[model samples]
Target: MSAPDAGGESTRDREPVLRVRGLRKAYGERLVLDDVDLDVHAGDVVCLIGSSGSGKSTLLRCLDLLEPVDDGTIHLDGVEITDPAVDERAVRRRIGMVFQAYNLFPHLTVLENCTLAPRHAHGVRRREARDRALGLLERFGLAGHADQHPDRLSGGQQQRAAVVRALCTRPELLLLDEITAALDPELVGEVLDIVRDLAAGGTTMVLATHEMSFAREVATTVCFLEGGRILEQGPPARMFSDPTHERTRSFLKRVLAP
Candidate 1:
């Protein structure tokens, strides 16, 4: 499939890796996501940027089927994943999610944590899973710490391991929800660097982030969400330098302020 152009419009006749339409989610009286629409083509690194409570994280969760939407449809690779008969576990196998918190098993070593999902959930062979886990760990500079528990690693190391764990599944698409939110200021760069590498390697990813500068640098497309809607979306260059929406401009002003 051909990649979308800089305007976020497809350049060829190909289905997006992930497609969302008229999505709505709410918590009783509070409407969190309202009629959201998104399309992520293969190899697209789409960034969702907004302040707290802007529904960025919720949208990612909904995409992963961790939270059921009150309305709308989600399609992965042209299949309707939100269908009632679709097996969520099967869908999740093709989509990897890394959360803000490391969420590593306290009792498991880093290698064990990385191999667990692939081996158990996806039914990959134990030895194969182990080999893949070790390879990813080595690639991410975590091989030396593979035998250690999560608590023993620094915040940056733990998050890197978390990313490695997600990659171990060999997912077709990755969803990251503020993966650097829990890290110390200095540690953010290390985790973001892994994402940069992944982007360069053509990984299809959708991420909710506050790291505006990193998003501008790494994202093929940047989306600004406000009040549970995407106010503006375009190439990172245009979205960062010249947003078309007033709300988006105001947001960029505050976040980009020195």
Candidate 2:
């Protein structure tokens, strides 16, 4: 993990879009992730599920190099980038992430917030960025509110805007860490509706979430993690219907229980 070449040398024929091996993270003496491994293919939606504090968010952050790893390596399409010293800006530019808290700037209009990143990150002109933002907003039915501030929009609308902001980066990988956790149950469906469309479009996505129903339907693979370790992973039907690990079965029972 210390050296740039320390990552697993075993790569597939097509090469995964994002790969992580033996990933570990610690905050002081508290271990957040322990010996984790994952891969996201070109057109796959892999959903990582676990109880709260199971290292889902930490794993996502580590993939994007937002949080430095204590041990392990990450690669994007066979390109090693999570070595001891990685290009942080370049890595972030290739990975688009949406967090639970929208994190929109209240002072800036929705249009500005969505377009600013593209303008600064890629040197896109103001007019071009504005046009791009408008196009993305219209995809989620938010074109009419482009001029409004964050506070003026509903929770669902704000979350959709955050998704558009991340899309404006034109990233190859999209990481969503429980983006609907803070919204009302009714509002949650609206935001998820947009995500559903993206999944249908065969976007490469890695989602850490509690939306079992949505994950079951849209994800090509589902992984159940417990205590920072992936207990089981397989096709959604095999995972939900025929889980082999006791922890996975228990977790599903609890999640599926009324």
Candidate 1 Cα outliers beyond 4 Å, as residue runs: 1-10
- Report the C-alpha lDDT of model 2 over 1-258, residue by residue, as the tens digit: 211211222354688898888888999998998888887789889899999999999999888888988998888989888766767898898889999999998989999999988898888999999999999999889999999999999999999999999999888999999999999999999989988999888889999999999889998888787777776777787788877777788888999998
Give per-residue lDDT, candidate 2, residue 216.
Answer: 91
Identify the leading candidate in terms of lDDT: 1
Worst 10 residues of 2 by lDDT: 1-10
| Candidate 1 Cα lDDT to native | 0.92
Name the best candidate (by TM-score). Answer: 1
lDDT of 1 by residue, 1-258 (tens): 112224845565799899999899999999999888888999999999999999999999999999999999999999999999999999999999999998999999999999999999989999999999999999989999999999999999999999999999999999999999999999999999999999999999999999999999999899888888876788999999887777889999998997
Q: State the TM-score for model 2.
A: 0.94
Error of 2 at 228 (Å): 0.9
Residue 155's lDDT within candidate 1 is: 96
Which whole-number lDDT from 0 to 100 does residue 110 have in model 2?
Answer: 97
